[model samples]
Target: MTAALAVRNLGRDHGGGQAPALDGLNLDVPAGSCLALVGPSGSGKTTALRLVAGLEVPDRGDVLLDGRSVVALPPERRGVSMVFQRPLLFPHLDVLDNVAFSARVAGASRRAARAAAAPFLDLVQMGGYTTRRPGQLSGGQEQRVALARALAARPRVLLLDEAFTGLDVALREDMHELLHQLRAVLEPTVVLVTHDHAEAAALADSVAVLSGGRLLQHGDAGRIYTRPASVTVSRLLGGRNEVPGVVVGGEHRSALGRLRLPTDVAVPDGPAVLLVRQEAVVVTGPDAPGADAAGTVLAVRAAGARRALTVEVVSPGGAAVQVHAETSPGQVFTRGERVGLRLPSSAVSAVPPEDAGTEEPEIADRRTADAGRMPRTHRVASPAVPDAGVRPDAPGAPRRRNHHGDHGT
Candidate 1:
């Protein structure tokens, strides 16, 4: 299958004491499928969209639409339409006229443009508000109208840059449903840029994760979420319980105790990082049999349907590890109480350690360049594992025990 859109070796530089906005970024969007560009602020999500839209020229590489290069083509010439974070509607035009404007620009008569835009307005569920002006409509309603307008151009590719960022949770969900329904009917290739993982998971068939203008990983959303290519990608996708450990033989040894490696995961025998999902760590009574390790509860916070606990576990060598776990609402545990924790081998995977010498400096440079462009609050911070102080093994310290009975040599 040929790609509907292709970005090959894309590079962009802002210059003037700033690092490149995008460097060596590449991605592909299959025809009639949705691909989401997700990452922290200043990760070049918007820059990638703009390069494909012809709003900005790339310093290197090319943007291709259906195997044809469009890097030098103007935005109007490319068969692409972009929706920004805010609705860029014409103030003087009513919702109907705004939706019809694109058709009219393409030389359709006023009557013909309105006729062409009517079905799209209905597609977005904005048919009833056709006579309202942009100022009179709510944010969600305006966005709906903006979407209808974009469709009026009959674009082969639709680009959305944080298009739903301003709406409330309920409205954002409604828009997601609308987009899904519209995609079923129109089947246009879509590229969405968002910081919300839920939005990406809900709308995208595939996700491309970026960090510091570089593509970290790109694959099916389910695979990316469950088996991220690196610790950085795992963190971006909300894999929170990262433990520093080492791989010996075919098992992993960490503060949580030794765990057997699954056959599918292949990692070199050396220093590694174990990525564990919060739901995978089972917390039980301290005396529970078959427990992997024992830890003291440091904090418990109520999440929506479950509660999150911060547990501090100690290794035999006195190294301290802090991990997060989630439990049901019915289960209650207090701080300072001892609890038994189990790290299931099935839910754990190992990846090579992050090479700080190369990636960190580029990330810092991108952050500096994006300081003024994006609000500080909008930037997604790199995930950090809370550290528990390392101390000498006290008298009667808990002995190392492998509940799985798979201790590594």
Candidate 2:
């Protein structure tokens, strides 16, 4: 099947000695499927979305829609619709008028536009709020209308730029469910840009990871989370237990202990990194016979349904490895208690070091010492929409600008 959208060698350079916002980027979104772009700020997620939306032309490469080149097409003529972080609804228009705005722009009469938009508003659970103006609606309500507006346009492709950001957890989850239900009904090709990994995993069939203006890896959510291509990707996907180790035969020798490598992982006999999910580290008393490693509990904290334990284990070579383990709520352990850790071999995978000589013993020792106080996750303020490196009045295209920076991905 042909891809609904194809970005081929897309590149964009923001002049004045700044790095290229996007470099040699390429991606394909299969027809009727949702693909998410996730990465850190200034990683070119918005730049890529703008290029596909025809809001910014790429400095190099072409965009294809339905197997046809759309490089010369304008955003309005490309059969695409984009929803920004803010609703961007017209203040003068009520929810119904705002949703019908797209249909009206496409040449439908006002009566016909409202009639066409009714189903979409209802589709997003905003039928009762049709008469309410944007100012009268809550943030979530306004966003629902925004989605209704985008869908009412009858777009063949829908682009969502962190459309769910800034909402409370409960509302955000509601929107996710709404998005999935709408996708099943409308079947439009979707490309979502998000900084939230959980949102991407929940909404997209596949995810493409970007960093430093480059594509690192692209695969299904499960594969991307479990078998990331690099340490950067692993960390971005929330892999907190990264242990530097060496491949010995088919097993990996790490500071935690020796673990059998997954049969599918093909790494040469050399230094590598072992990624273990925090949930996989089973904790038991020191006397547990099958424990592969033993550690002293530095701290234990209750986190909702699970208990989290910080452990410091010494390898046979005397190198220290700090690991975090989660156990059932019923199990309790005190600080300074000895515990045995079972690092399941099946839950471990080997990846090459991000750089040569970056996994030395000294580095591991330092990390082990510092791991106790590190935050569970790191977060940065989302970046603003990056400049496309193209002038607003570049020939036939009129200048358009969004001040909010890119919201998510």
TM-score of 2: 0.86
Instruction: Please report the TM-score between candidate 1 and the true structure.
Output: 0.83
**Candidate 2: worst 10 consecutive residues by lDDT?**
383-392
Error of 2 at 43 (Å): 0.4
Name the regions of candidate 2 deviating beyond 4 angstroms: 1-3, 284-291, 301-304, 328-332, 356-409
lDDT by candidate, in order shown: 0.78, 0.78
166: Cα error in model 1, Å = 1.0
